[model samples]
Structures are given as structure tokens and as C-alpha cells.
Target: MAGKVQKIKDWKGSEQKGTLKLQEAEVPRAALTDAISEDILCDLAELFKVFGDSTRIKILYDLFSGEKNVTEICRDLEMNQSAVSHQLKILRTAKLVQGRREGKSIVYALADEHVKMIIAMGIEHTEE
Candidate 1:
């Protein structure tokens, strides 16, 4: 099988053992220019950074079921109120979640359908 494999000119193998090779490709300058702007790229990076935390992921998973207040989230996830609030602050800043005043407490939920889609896709990928 190794002998039957074909190699491309733009891909080069690394000298180190058990490491993957790097592949280079040329894309049109027009396409590159029309691609995401630097500011948007930075914002996207910031959004993904929020998703990188396991605690935040748990909070998000619970929120997926329905909206819940900080106290409820803490109780359901077995996390402390302060810790949940801190994570909620980060999630809110990233626009992944939003909260609304409900009587004496604020109920939080996914910010938009995009948040649900992101979480759904992540779960699908992991299951596969």
C-alpha cells in the first residue's frame, strides 16, 4: 500500500518520527481578499476560546435544555454560584448566551439559534 500511494508536489513530510507532513496550496488572491476580515477573524477566535472551557461547555449543555437562572445552573451542574456566574459572564461576553430579568432572578438562555447550531454540530462531531 505504501508503494502504491501517490504524493503531491506541494506536500512535504517532516523529518521527525510519528509526525504528519505539511501541505501547501495556492488559493486565488481575490478569494483571499474576500475572505473573513482580520477583525472578524479575531472575534471568531475569541468566540471559540469561550467554547474551549469544559465548565463553560457543561453550562452550555445544560442551557441547551432550557433557560435557567444562576442558582438553578449551579444546583443542576453541581457548581458553585460564583463559579457559574463567572462562566456566565464569559459566555455572555462571547454572545453565546444571554440573560433576561425574570422577577427577582435573571434567567439565562442561548443567545440565538447560532449557539444551538454550534453546540449541536459539536455534539454530532464527537459522537462520530
Candidate 2:
């Protein structure tokens, strides 16, 4: 198993001492330090949690095409306004989507290019 770490365990199911193997190339020290902060790690976890909901994922996929209001999302997803709005609030809080006032309605869109890239990469990974 290239690039895999193997932890040797004893009969009691406890990890053995000094049997850890890093069989592949070592990870860069800079890469290790860059992601070590607890706050950043927790934030990343929270962001992924936001993506765990099917409703939120559909809303994000809908927004990928362009900005749409609550009504449009509900119609497109065949859901009620309340449910769509609730998921939209979650998406907005996670900074995955943004809304702006247009006349009397609020049009929602992907927060930025990073969000599009994230969704695109996710789709690509799942398709494979």
C-alpha cells in the first residue's frame, strides 16, 4: 500500500510501540503546519457538515446555474417555501450562498468562485 500508514497492534488490540510505518514520501513540513490550527480544522469540519444535508446540496446545485429567489428555489425543487427558506438560511450561515435584494425579492447565488469550485470538485469526485 503505497502512501499509506500502518499501525501495528498487539493481541489485546492495543497499538504496539514504535511500529508505525510511514512507507511513502514524507509530507512537507509546511503542509503539516499550515493545517494544524484547531480553529481552522473545526471550521473545515463545520463547513463539511453544512454540505451533508440533501436539501442544502440541492439548493446549492440550483444556485450553481444562477441567482434565484426563495420562490424559484421552491418551485425548482418541488418543495415548500418554508423548507427552502430554512435550508437557505443554513447555506447562507455557512457562507456557501449569498443573497441580495432585488426589488422586493432577495436573489440568492453562490458566495464566490471558491464555492463553485468546491461543488464542481464534489460532483467530479462522485461521478467517478
Candidate 3:
């Protein structure tokens, strides 16, 4: 059977001027079958959402160098302890940051090299 051609329409419920015909093309079934699962796609989207907030990005940037207590983070970022802690909680839940008890305070740092690479790539992209 011949491929189907679709009419390109415009907003006024009429055929557009100088309209181009769109033909259905054969898709690779293997590519579709090998695509990531919907659950994994949703999880990846959620992870990117965690990086969407400026406050969280600032917190991650601060933790890039070394582990820091909440007080030190607040002092460096000039943010309040409560605000910094709140952002940290979200970061921890996303597994982007990890914290360990240091004496009376909890020191926080990036969870792994993946986080650093992601941030570094983002910075490089923006610079370019």
C-alpha cells in the first residue's frame, strides 16, 4: 500500500497557503522497543526537577568543594540556617547530597562524582 499523505491545516480551519504534504514514515520497531521505560523516564524528570530550583543549585555549588555544616553553608551563601536546611532536605531526598554527623553538626557533601559531572557540564554548557 502507498503511504498516506496528511493535509497541513492552519488556525482558521482551512488549508494553509503553500502547504507541505506530510507522509507517514516507517519507524524502527527495535528503537521503540529498546526505549527507556515510562517509570524510569518519570524518575529522571523528577531528578531534573530537583535541579530546577536556584536555591538548591546554590546549595549544590557550595557543596562541590568540600563537606560543609549547615552554619557554614548559610554563612557562605548568606542564607538563613532554616532556609539552607530546607533546601538540603530536598537535595538529600533526591540523593544528590549526603550528610554525615560531624560532632554537634551535620556536614553535607555531593553524593557522588555523577552529581559533580552533571553540574560541571551544565556550567560548561552555559559558558558556551
Please give, for residues 23-96, the per-residue lDDT of candidate 2 as tens digits.
Answer: 22334455544546898889999999998888898898777667899999999999999999999999999999
Predicted candidate 3, C-alpha RMSD: 15.7
Q: How well does candidate 2 match the true structure, expressed as C-alpha RMSD?
A: 14.2
Model 1 residue 108 CA deviation in Å: 0.5
| Candidate lDDT values, in order | 0.76, 0.74, 0.76
Residue 46 displacement in candidate 3 (angstroms)? 0.3
Give residue 45's error in model 3 in angstroms: 0.4
Which of the predicted structures, 1 or 2, would earn the higher lDDT when compared with the native?
Answer: 1
- The residue ranges of model 2 lying beyond 4 angstroms of the native Cα positions read 1-33
The residue pairs that clash in candidate 3, if any, are: none
lDDT of 1 by residue, 21-103 (tens): 33544545554456788998998888888999999998987876678999999999899999999999999988889999999
TM-score of each: 0.71, 0.72, 0.72
What ranking of all candidate models by TM-score puts the best one first?
A: 3, 2, 1
